[model samples]
Structures are given as structure tokens and as C-alpha cells.
Target: AAGAGAAAGAGAAAEDVPEVERESPAKAPVARRRRTVLLAGTAVVAAVAAAALVVNLVPDKGHNDRSGKQSVGTAASESVDSSPDASEPSGAKGRSASPSASRSGSPTASAPASVSASRSREAAAAQGGDGSADGATAPAVAVNPYKWEDPCSQHYLIDQNPEQVPPPPAEPDARGWVNALGGVAGGQQMLALTVQGTGKATVVLEALHVRVVEKSAPLAWNDFEMGVGCGGGVETTSFGVDLDAGRPSLSPKAGQRDFPYKVSESDPEVFYVFADARTHNVSWYLELDWSSGDRHGAVRLDDKGKPFRTSGNVGRPAYTYPLGDTEWGRNESYPDIPG
Candidate 1:
């Protein structure tokens, strides 16, 4: 009866407490879970705010690295490429030292001086400049139209005959032999000159001029006893220059046409150049003027950068090596062969 009365009293006290604050009659532990959802929501909001703050303050390391690498790469490229504002670097000395090699290696400088200068001017004009302030020339284009034959390949008239003609040696040896003989070319030199374009663009050959470097008496070192066959063929166009003249110039044959000819890779032109020196030993070269599009230039032609030399063999000493004879014999008539 005492336990029942105590229970009744506790139940009457529970009725005074708020329903939400009252524990269930089953004795479920509800206080621990009451605010669990609200706490979880507050924790999530705090984590998101911290993440946003970090994102706004820190920069991407990878992006910065790439930008730095790009700047270095740009500088490297600029060093390799030619700049229109500066003088040539030491690297360019190789090109300037060997004009002949450069002439053959690149198309822009391969042409005559006038044509080369003209092309350079036109290129500068196109870019709104007049070349570099330091006087550096323009870069070379890949295409070059000048096709030169070996100077030693062509047959030359040497007044001196070989002691014993054997099979010819290499071209270098042949050139050396001519030099050893003190030969300035006897009779005439027949040079086979060919011209074409690098691409489909046509090049116009305006004129061929002669420049006289030196004139003197016929060389006595070339005085020899015998003469061999030294003849060359002719083409549609041929020019003859009289080295003995006061001012030597190119003259066409009676039927040959003058210059202002056009040429391309598919349609090349072959010209036979005949230089005669009957009285004076002359050192000279040929100047060729040409143009293509807005580019014009002139080029000098010679025997491996040296002027073409020729001398008249009017009254020089002569010898004869008859076909059947084993030793050289003196021919009574020098500079003349008896038929």
C-alpha cells in the first residue's frame, strides 16, 4: 500500500512537468538525441565557410609554374630568330665569311648584286622598313636558282701541252695543273652558263655586262710548243667579249638575240659565253642583272670567285708532240699547226 501510494504521488508530479520535457513511461533515453540534428547542421555550415576562405586566398602552384616556363620558352625562340633591330651575332660570322657558299646555299644572295639589292628593298618596303638600322641584310629564302657547273669541268685552251698526256686526274688536280703552268687561258674561254628559277615564279634576265679588272701584256709563262683540241658548242643565245677592246662588253652573234629573257625551273636557259683575247691578257668577270616580282638584283660570275683570265697567244713559243713521237719536239712554226 506504501509503494502504490508513492507511485501515485510520482505520477501526479509528472503531470505538472511539460509534455516535451517529460520522459516517456517506457523510460526511453530521449535527452541524449534531442539536439543531435541541430548540432550536425551547425558543424556542416562551419566546414563549408572554412573551405570557401581557403579557395579565395591560395593561388594554383601548377598554373604559376606553367606561366614561368612559357616566358622562358619565348625568350629562347627570340634568340634563335633574327631581330630586325640588332646587329648580327657571332653565329652569323660563318655565313658572312663564305660568300660563295652562302651564295649557293641561299636563293636570295645567289642572284646578282642589283637583283639581290632590289629584292631586299622590296622585302623591306613590304614590311614598312628600310632594312635594319645596323645594316644587317634580310634573311635568306630557301629557293635559289643559280646552278653553276664546275669551273674545272669546262675545257680550257692552254698553250702549254702536257709532257705526257695520261688519264685526267680529279678536278682539283686539273685546276692546280693550270695554275702551275702560269696559264691565263690561251685562245678563248668558253663558259657554259645556265639559269632557271627555284619555283614556278619566272625570273627575267635584263642584261649581261662585262667588268674589266686588269689588262696587261700576254703572259710569257704560257709560252709552250704544242696545241691540242679545245672547242665548245653553241646554244640559242651566245655572247662574245673582246678582251683587247678599250672597254670590253658582251656582243651577240650576228643572228643571236639580246637579253630580257624569262626563265623558270621547267624552262631553263643555257648561254654560251665566248671570251677572246688576241693582243692583251685580261682579267674580267660578267655581271648579270635580273628581276622577279618586286625584287631586282645583279650577280657577278667568274671562275670560283676569281676573275676569268684570258691572253692572246699571237707570237708565243711553240712545241709539238706528234702522235707517234715518244718525246716532245720543237715545231718550226709556233702558234700555228701544219696540216
Candidate 2:
């Protein structure tokens, strides 16, 4: 009986122990897992919020970067538009004026002077001054129409054997003479006259008058060796004719010989006279008279059929007339002589 009672007492003691206390180990692990899960969920939410905040910060930098690029683009466009050295023609006028103000010694110095004058006129106009902008600008000059002359129509019969004529006296004051004899040569006749200007200003060739003189007149004779194979002797006379007066005369003064000839810039004027020898005959004399600036001058052919300036100076030949034979005939018809 006493042993049964002790066992009962021990069983009661075991029952008296708390049920929560008995399951504490397993329940503590479950509670720790739940807390871990909650903590993990909170950490995940913080990471997501941090990523969103970083994304928001990135947009600001991106916006600033885009804005900077746009500003740079705008500046580049402005620089290009206002560039004085731009090649666009539309900007030429503006560029011409600006560079003169900021810089000097450029090739556009002349442009600046003109621009300053235009600006002064504009300022005067703004102040209600009498300067008219339109009047301040020079009017455009009219260009003359280019008309080709028919040299073949001016052909005349001349003595091919000019050596038969008597030579002029040895005295410098004595005049020479010329005579005409009929002859024909089978060859091409091509004449080219080229006039070039080297000055920085425009050259005006006003009143270009040409005339043909007969061989019966007294001319200044000079010994000229013509290398052409026309069977004509080389002894020739150097003479000058007044193209404007349509008369043969002696050479003029050196200063007077350069009259009516102006050269500006580098443009060249070319005149051509081509004729097949089968149809046309060689003429006697070719005289040229022209006016340039305030001067007038005349040119004529020497005895050797070469044109030369009357001044007898040898630097730059203001005018050149080269005559030669053509290997092939031109198909174009010659125009009639002008009235």
C-alpha cells in the first residue's frame, strides 16, 4: 500500500508541472521562426524603399544631364549661327560688319569700311537725318553687250612683194611709205586679241574703235623680219593710225599712247577673228582706239603684221594680237559686217 501511494504522489507531481513549460523548447523555436520571418519581411520592405529612393535620385541626375546637353546644343547652335567666318552667303553681310569691329588686319578690311559707312547711314536714318540709305548705296553699273565684229569683211588686196617699195630716208624725221599690189595666199587666217587687267580696280575699255588703212599713205618704215611663209619680204614700216579719226598718222607721245586704257582686277577680254584663206584676203592695216579712265590710246600693226602699242615700251603688253593658220576649218558661217 505505501509503495502504491508514493507512485501516485510522483504521478501527481508530474501532472502539476505547467503544460506550456513542458512544450517551451518546441514553442520557442516556432516563435523564433515567426520573428525571423517578420524581420526578413521588414528588411525586404526597406530594400524595396531604398531602391525606389535610389531610382528617384537617378532621375534628378539624368534630368540635369539632359538639361546640360540641351544647353550645350543651344550654345553650339548660337555659335554656328553667329560665326563671322561662316561660308553661307546669307551670313556674309552680317559677318562682314562684325569682324571689323572685333578684329582688324583681316582680308575683310575693305568690307568693314563699307559696313561702317552703311551703319553710319543707318544711324543717321534712325536719327531722322537727311542721309537716304538707298542713296548712300551706289547704283549698279550697266554692262555693255558684247558684239563680235566680222574681220573677214574688212579684207582688201595688198601688194605681197612689199620689198619693191623704196626705203625711207635715214633721217629720223623722214616718213615711210606703203603701196598695195594684188596677191592671194592659200592659208588660214586666225586673229586673237586678248586684253587682261591686273589692277585691283575695274578697267573700263570705252569706245573701242577699229579702222583699216590703205597702203598708199606715207608710213613710218622699220625693218621687221616676219617668219611667216607668205613669200613676202621682211622689210616693213611701223605706223600708227587714229582709229577714232579713221586716218593714218605717226606715233603719239608716250603718255598720250596709254590713254583710254584701264585695267582692274584680273578679268581678261578676248576677241577672235577667224577666216579661211580660201575665201578672205589679208588686209592692209588694223588700228585700235580705246578709252580707259581719263586717258586714251591707239594701237596699230607693224610692217610684219604684228600689232603693238604705240608707246614702244616693252613691259607688259597691254594688248596682244596673235595671228596663225588653222588646221581645221570652223563650221559656223561668218556674220555680215555691222552698219
Which candidate comes out best when scored by lDDT? Answer: 1
lDDT of 1 by residue, 238-329 (tens): 77888899988888875898888887657778787778777788888887776666555666777655787877766555444445666655
Q: What is the C-alpha lDDT of each candidate?
A: 0.59, 0.35
Model 2 Cα lDDT, one tens digit per residue, 1-339: 999999999888878776657799878999999999999999999999999999866766545656765556555555555655543466455544334333432333233223333444455456565233223221111111111122222222123323442322222211122122221211222234454543343445443333443222212222111121224211111112332233433342222342344444355554432222221222333434433333333444223332211211111111111145322221122122111
What's the C-alpha lDDT at position 338 in model 2?
13
Tell how far residue 78 is off in model 1, in angstroms: 9.7
Clash totals for all models, in order? 12, 12
| Predicted structure with the largest TM-score when compared to the true one | 1
Task: Candidate 2: count the clashes.
Answer: 12
Error of 1 at 185 (Å): 0.7
Could you tell me the TM-score of candidate 2? 0.22
Model 1 compared with the native: what TM-score?
0.52
